[model samples]
Structure formats: C-alpha cells, structure tokens
Target: MSAPTIVAADLPAPADPLAQVAIARAAFASGRTRPVAWRLRQLEGITRLVEEREAEIAAALSADLGRSAVEAWLADIASTKGEAEYARKRLRWWMRPRPQPLPLNQLPATAWIKYEPLGTVLIIGPWNYPVYLTLGPLVAAVAAGNAAVIKPSEITPATSALLARLIPEYLDPEAVTVVEGDGAVTQQLLAQGFDHVLFTGGTEIGRKILEGAAPTLTPVTLELGGKSPVVITADADLDIAARRIAWVKLMNSGQTCIAPDYVLVERSVRDAFVSKVVDTIRAFRQEEGTNGLRIVNERQFDRLASYLDATSGEVATGGVVDRDRLTITPAVVVDPDPDEPLMTDEIFGPILPVLTVDSVDDAIAFVNARPKPLAAYYFTKSRAVRKSLLDEISSGGVVVNHVAMHCLVPQLPFGGVGESGTGAYHGKWGFEALSHRKSVLSKPFAPDPQFVYPPYSATALKIMRKLF
Candidate 1:
C-alpha cells in the first residue's frame, strides 16, 4: 500500500528537550506504565507504528541517508518489528518472579526476585539506523514497564522528525516521548538525570555521554563503534566468506558499528580470498545497479575519501568517488601500512582492508593487540580451530562462518567489551538491563524464637549455635 506523505505541519514542533524528559518522568511516577497489560499495549503500539508506517519510515530514511526502500525495511523496519514482537511474546515469562534457593538458617522464609521498572529512561540514537537504534531500546524500556524519552540524532533530521510525529500518534503519548535536537540538547537532557541512559554512536561521543551521566550517577549503556575484525582461515570457504564479508561491508555504506572493519586472512588463502572478495563486490554492485554507494553526509564522505587517498596499499578494486553525489565506490585495500588511518581508525565506510597473516595464531594475536571489537568474525571448517579462537579472543560476540548475524538473533545479548560498548541489550537481556530486580523475602512472625533475640543466656546461646 502507498504510504501517505508526512507533512511538516502534521508533525508536532520539537518539544523543549527538558520538558519532554519531565513529561516522561511524570508519566513514570503516575504508575500507569507498570502493569503487564500496559506493557503489552505499548509493545503492540510499536508493532502498529512499524506496520502502518513502513512507507513513511522508508521515505524518511531515504531523505536522510539516501537509503533504498529494501535496505530501510531490512535494517530499520523489520529488525525493529522483530524486536518488539519477540519482547511482546516473551514479556510475561520475563516478568515472572524467579524463586531463590534459601540457606539453612532461613528455612521458614521464601525468597524470589521480582523485576520492576527503572522509571524514566533516555535513549540517544545515532544517524545510522536511527529508527531501529532508538526504538530498539524503547522496546526494552516499555517491556520493563518504564516511561521513555527517545532522542533521535539530529544528523538524520528527516527520520527524527518522522519519529516525533509517529511515536505520539501510535504509542501512549504520556509514557513515551521523542525529543529532537543537537548534542547540546542531549547535554541538557543528561543534566536532568534520567533513571538510565542508552547512547549508540562513536566511541568519542560515548565518552562524553559517560562524563555527562557521571555527575548524576546515572547508569549508561553505550553502543559505541570500534574496529571490528574478521579472520579467514586456510580451510575456510572463500566463496561464502567473501560473499558475506562484502555484503555486510556494503551495508549502510559500511557505517555499521559491527561491520567487519578489516580482514586477517591466512597467508595461504589471502590472494584467493582477495580475488573472490573483489569479484563479489563487483557482482553485488551490478545487482544493485548502483555505480557508487551513498554516504550519510559530506563530513563522512570526506573522511572516507581521505582514507582512500592516503592509503599506501594497493586498491584491489573500486577506488572511485563521486563528490557531487556524496558517494564512494567500494574499495578493497590489500596490506595497507598498519599505522595508516585506514588501519588505525574505525573506517565507517565502504572500504575493506585485507591483511595476510601467517596462521590462525597470528590472527588471534593480531586482534588481541587491538581494542576488543564489538564483534569478531571467523570463517573456518575446523571445530578445534573455531573452539581455539572462541577461547582465546574476547569480543562482544562472535560468529563462525558468518558476519554480523548475532545482532539479528533475539535470544543472544548484543553489546561490546572495553571500548566497543558497555552494556548489552536484546530480547531478555534488554529487558533485564532496563529493569530493577527487587529481592523479596517472606517470613511468618509466629515463627520467631526467643534465642534469636539479643539478651541471650548461656543455655540459649548454646542452643542458638546448634539450631538457629
């Protein structure tokens, strides 16, 4: 069905950032959002928002980032719908109180943990995949029965504006709010000190969010970006490995936080793998019927173009850029200098660097020396090799024979280690992260014993030591 056009007059004017947060806090205090039925209603509202506004969301994404309709549906719409559906189906199970095993001394008591809301939560989203990142955390917040204030990235104004318009229409306007503005506005919101904050963006910005939340002692979940790496073994399927890597690298023009930043291929298969990767890129580009991939904006385009200009390695394929259109053809750099920007910094673009390593041991050592990535990918047929890599390397998550599939799996926790990110949130993990597990213990007053009281005699003390 054709989606209706979003008119600027129809969208509510950008709310006063502080006032928006205040509204959410007030809504949370009203106790209206805590019931299981209310949580389900909000979850269902999110599903309706996505279902009824698919075309609008796609149009907003295209206006903001030049994203294709199919790409928008896959990355932002379907993924978000999946998260809400999963949470809606499992929230009842997630909310059930878990019984705890009591110690011998507490025999007459029963204990269990009950999940409760964390009050108002603030979700600061990034330009890339703005809707999914913003609403994905909101799913957790609402499922945990907390009011939410969503802060969409200013860089993607079209998507942000659309969200501001749509969220209030579909969700409970009092319980969930969308605040739109630049970083300073974010700072103002942080100062208000929400119960919890989740920010998804670059590492440098993540540090600022941490600092901003520090004064308030507000906990934060930072979904920051880093140089996520991929390792290809000698026995790996080059055909499958190349196709997967190339496909993910081209996603969102490689602006994804979990996109394989660089490749460490075994020396024996380096040349063949590089060849296949180049072929795969060419084939995919032809299939998509695009000469160059669109970058979000000029700053990102300039950063990516500069990396291409400065790289010392051979460009195996695709070194073209169209400045007028703000797009860059995919480029594969082979064995660039390790100290260059292409190797040192997180290349959030359609640039792939394939580095040759002596063995899987060398690949492990190489990844270990760098900051732990948000994800690490390995393509190997050997069980022992996969097990060894799994044991030796530490990342937010790892995928064998694939790339970035972990994010789509609702059962697994998705996050980073060290610099890549701080906390995990997806499915139940997300529900738990956004919840406060309160421990409750019930005991009968009639069971109280005289020896348990303070002023005990020698006989009572002896009995307490044996039977209390």
Candidate 2:
C-alpha cells in the first residue's frame, strides 16, 4: 500500500532527499566514521545532547504530544541517554573480531567474523516517542560506524523540527543528516538505496517501507506494532500488576508500541485485578492530572473514540472524550466482544480493554490465534505458569510480573515478531543489526592442495573428500 501523504507545513521538506543520502554516503566513504574514537565521540555527543537539552526536548515533546516534562524525560530523554551511554562503554569490545571454530576438514586455516559498517543507513522515526525511537537506531548505526539519514515523523512536527535543528549541532553534520517531511519524503529516501533501513511505525507502513526499498534490495529492520496482550494469571500480585500496567498504559497516552494493548485475566481474579487497575488509573491521573490522555492527531483521536463506541463490553471507568482537545480519558472496558474493533485492533490509546478467560489455556489460545505481538506480558508468581506462558506464547519478547521493562534494559533486544516487527536493536544487538559480519579466513599458500583446486582425478577426489 502507498502510505498516506503527510506534508509538514512548519518544517520544509528536503529539497533533495537523494542528496541527503548522497552526503551521508560520501561521509561514510571518507572512512572518518570507521575509527573507534569517532564512534565513541558520536555516542558521547548523543549523551551530551540529551543531558544539556533536556528542557528543550521536553518542551518539544510537550508541544508535539502533550507529554509532561517527567514523562518526556523518562520516555524519550533518559531512555535514549542510557542506550547511547551503554553503547559508548561497550562499543570497542563489540567491534573486536570474533574467532570462529573451523571444522576438522579446514584445520590448517583460521577464520573469524569481522564487524564492519554497512555504509549509509536510513532511520525512520515514529511520532509517539519521536526522539528516542529515531535516535536510538542512530545510536546503533553510528556505533556500527555507518553514516545515517534520520527521517523524523511529520505527525510530531515540533519534535521533528527540533530534531532536525539539534542533531547536526551535536553530531557530525555530514555523517548524519535529518530530513523532515512526510511519507513521500520517506519513499524518496528509500529510493536512494540506503545500505540498510530501520523503520519504526505501524505494520502497514512497514509493508510500504519494504516495498519502497525493494528495488534497491535494501535490507530493513522494521519495529512495527501489534496488539501486545497482558496475561494476568490468578496467582499474580494484583496490586503490583495494576500499578505496572496502568503506568505503561498511561505513558505517551498509550501510543507506545509495546504498551499492553489488551488484558487477558483468569476469571477467578478478574474482578479484583480490574478494580485495582481502574483504581490505579484514577490515582495516577489524580496525581499527574492526566484525566484526559492526549492523542497525537484527529485521525488517531477518532479511531480510538470509535473503539470505545463499538465495544460491546461494559465500561468500568473513565470513558470521557473531548474532541476539541483531542484527549480521551483513561478508560477500562470489561470483556469486550472478541470480534469488536476494541478487541481486534491495536488500541493505541488510553482506553484499555480487560477480558476474562476461564484458564491460562483460554488466554494462550486467544493470543496465539492472532498474529504474534511485539511483546507478551504475563503477571504470575508461579514458575510453572511463567514457563507455560513463555513456552506456549510466541512473541518478540516477554516480561514476567512486569510490563514494558524489557525495553529499558539495553542487555535485552527490542523488536517485534510476525506482524509486530522484523529485527531487534538495543546495545550489542543494535550494533550487530546495522553492521555487516564479514567472514575472514586465512590459510598458508604452501599448504594449499592441488586436489582441492583442479579437475578431480578419482584418487585426488577421494583424498579431497576425506580432507575437504
């Protein structure tokens, strides 16, 4: 599908998208970015940018997504800073060649895998957590020693413009360029044949991105979203589960890709858990004055509103919607019809649906019946139950007794599965994702056998087969 055209009026589209790619490509060719020192410097620059410009980034986030300063810092600034710092500390070790064990047939040779840059790459940022998602991949790209072109989403114009302005000032200008435009601009950049492209957005957009990159055969890493289900086992801690679920659900007004899209609670504890979750939402909103969760735009606002309208489920609390402000109050719907849009579609809003299942089997069946989600969250105390869910459910990642904490740790890879996303990137995973692992083998010319090189005589063939 051709992605809908979105022109950013405030931020002018790049005059030449290919030129942006060309500049990065030229920069990559210069070999300046290849050095370990340069990689470390860029990582340091990212850390410094997030540190010194905390207020600016928060302000931009507020203007773009109505995010509070604390939420802004926690979600975008702090997370990104951590990722860059994590990479900076471990990049030299990551870049070192890893020796590969050779088979007995190749005993006289030595082989190793060398990590190298994939030249110029493209990082297409999403609007929700604009700064972090965009720059997080850049962290990986630069750490892998590749020049990159960052395409920040036009949906969040303020943050997009801010990124376009600030990125060059902090990092190497030629090696990294920010192109601000819409889907058309993204398509244009894809056509330029990047060495690799990492896109974070919806699965539909991901398909379009893949299509756009097809002609050039550009390798892509798609961080797309699906309905990540939160399974609450009967043996779980309801209070902690409620708090954790409400916390991530309210973040960025539930626009997060890995936020609990829906809940599947064992019937026995459904009421208690639902009540606690609703209460937690009330308490959280009261504390932060976030009764009305902000939606990015009218399209998203209307989409979320429709889910609330179509749901056959009973509303537990907070069903308020203000079209004027584009805000939908935090809501909990109990047992919506499985076929309903609220249950089926990815609810990228503050309105969460809580469904009750008789047993863990029912919950597993419900989740597995659908496309694999980016994340599957299970709140359980029992090791057996945790193991069951972990083994039976197929998702990109899983969190036990928590929601979305896996994303914060750079040790674990973050990405989606099936419709959710393609590849993962965090600390070392990100480094490896944007890098090429070239196999290097060395052998002495004196030991090279003629049987391995020539038209085979029967005796030579038998010898070659025995010692290939």
Candidate 3:
C-alpha cells in the first residue's frame, strides 16, 4: 500500500504555539539558565514534584490512554522520575570545566572546553509513551542548562493538560514551560528560531518538523518510530525470552515506539516460540484490569484496525477487536508477506507479526531492506552468533539476547540514522545536544614574537626561514 497524507481536519490544532516559544526565549534571555547550579536544582525539583504527585500523574495518564495506574506509573511516571535523578546525580560531572596548561611563552594564559547551554529548546512529543518521551528529553535539556518549551501530544489530552498546568508550578516556569496543542501549534513553534529542536513521533510528523525548522538552520534531534525488529533464533531459550518479551511488550497494550513490532523466528523453532508467546500473552492479559488493552482513542483504534483488515496474512492467534472495550486481543500474524499492510508501517499496537526466516543472514537482510529501525533485538545464548549479527546489522541501538534493554542503559547513545531519526540522546549525548563547545585560547602578555611579519628585509627573511 502507498503511504498516504493525513488531512487537515484529521490533524489536531497547534493553537497558541508561538507564545510559548516567546516565553521560553525571554526566559533564556534572562540568563537564569546560564548557571550549572540552577539547572541541577531544577532537575531535582522535577524529581521531587513527580514523587510528590505520583498519583496525579498516574491518573492523568490513565484517563488519557485508558491505561491502568500501575502501567502508567511503571511506564511514564517512573521513567520521568528516573530521568530527572539521572540528570541530577551526574550534573556536576557533566557541567565541570577542565583546566588546561598554558604554553611556556604565555604562562599566565589557560584554555579549556566549556559546555555552554543552547538557547530555548523546543521539544515536540509523541502520543505513544507521551510522558516519558516528552519528559526524558526535557530532563536532558534541563541537565544541559537550556530553557525548554515542551509541546506534549494533543491526542493524549489528560497528559498534555497535566504537564502544561503542573510543570510551571513545580519546574522553573521561566526555564521550562509546556505548550499543549496540536500540529498547528508545533508549526508555529518551529517558525520561531530555536537553538535546537527535539521531536519524538511518527516519520511523517518528523519530516514536517524538519521542514518547519529548516529556515533557521536549527539542528534537530528526532526520536521517531520505525518497525523495530526482534529475531528469535532456533538456539534461544523460548520460555525465558517469551515471558520477558511479553512483559516489556504488553506494558501499554504494545503502544510503544520501541516495542518489538514483529518477530523473525527460524522455521525449526517457529511453532515452539509462537506457542510460548501466545501463552505468555494470555497470562499477561489475564493479569491486566478490564481497561488493560485500551485502544488509546478512536483514531488510533481505527488506524490499528486498518492493519488487521488490510493485511493478507493469516492470523496465527488473536484477531479480535472490540471498540466498546477499547481493546484488540493480543494478535499474532504468521507468514505475512513483507509487502503486506501489517509489515508496511510501524505497528504500535498489540498486534505482533511473525515472519519465518531460514537463517540469520535472511533476517539481517530483511531488516536492512527497510529504513533503519530505532532498535533491533536478538534472543540467543550463542555469543558468536550475537557478535556476528551485531557486526552485520546497523541500528540506533541493539539488545543482545533480549529486547528493549538498551534504552534503559544511560551510557550508550540512542537515536536512529536515515529515516528512523537523525540524532541520539541519553547521558552525555543529551548534554552535547544542549551544550555548545566554544574553544577558548589565550595569548602571551608579551608582544608575541612574530616570525612571519610582512615587512621583511633579506636578513630578516633568512632568520624567519631558519626559525621556520
């Protein structure tokens, strides 16, 4: 199927976006964000605020996405809290300035790298895992000492409302502000010049952000979604892999940007892995409350449904969809053609497609044929196979013998190449994005010796040449 454009009526509002940008720029101009201590204190404040209002955050997420409080806490609130602390604990190290030795000719001078804050960052968030995606980057911006204006996803209104209303009260309203609205607002925000922009959402929207920010030549960090792959090898532990994968996946009814969209299993172990995954999913749903498998909203429900109807592949397990309950049964589609609708787009729902491949090379080729995914996973005990796979395939990040664990690690850089995304985040990369490295050099107090001065006599030229 051809990729289609979404109509204006279908799109949400971007009402009053520029005002937020202006507020943020004015705040940056105030120089309140220039100090490292102020940024660290702000990050700490975010952490304290989340802990104090955990219940409120959970409720907001639950109401918005029909997500359970437990799920909301685990996915959104906890993530934000962790990110805030992560930034806070490391702020000193991240902000420390190094001392450089001066040359013998200029002993009084010194030179060192300084991580200066980028002015007025604009963060455009995604609907899937809205709180984490929005706040995670915000945490990084705070850490780097940049004033940020956050644009939460309009599709998740409760979240957007909560963030916009509460963020200013807890955070430095001058340093951090939330602008709640749709694409129109985002375009308006992009129209205003920002030092940098960080966006997390679909590829189509990411493209619009890029185009909108193009005039100012403002750099952007896009945390867009793609069809991230998970390969289940024949030599893998089916039961262990199934349980862990299902646990991480069924968190938000599989409405995760980095969730394993599809699985590639060797034909020899296909049935066993399929059975394990199905049974595991069943167990997972039984534990969930009535609203566990929420379809987000009507629009997403329709979009997720389209994949099921348009796909030519036979359903391996559940194909059920109930709008009243706002749920789709944990679905597994087997033997799907790579060209089918189910395989075409990033499936950010409970549906899981299984593609059978004969060998690891075939799986690698399959993933490489499409746009570079945000992540890739392989569940195998074999070290050699893991190394070989890692060496062959390129992705934003990887999880060896597991799925989706790489993002949790604070050390590694996370972002996609080509279509998936442009830049990485987490840890130092976040600081790097928000900080500018301005090289500083000092010269000697003495009238500096000039070996190559313009007015050179023959004797002076000879001496200069000898010195050279």
Which is superior by lDDT, 1 or 2? 1
| Candidate 2 residue lDDT tens string, 4-43 | 2222344334468777777778889999999998888788
TM-score for candidate 1, please give it: 0.95
Q: Which digits, one per residue and each the tens of the lDDT, describe model 1 over residues 255-318?
A: 8999999999999999999999999999988865657899998999998999999999999998
TM-scores across all candidates?
Answer: 0.95, 0.95, 0.91
Alpha-carbon runs more than 4 Å astray in model 1: 1-15, 287-290, 458-468
* Cα distance off (Å), candidate 2, residue 437: 0.4
Which regions of candidate 2 are displaced past 4 Å? Answer: 1-15, 288-290, 453-457
Error of model 3, residue 442, in angstroms: 1.9
Angstrom error at residue 28, model 1: 1.2
What TM-score, to 2 decimals, does candidate 3 have? 0.91
- Model 1 clash pairs are none
Candidate 1: count the clashes.
Answer: 0
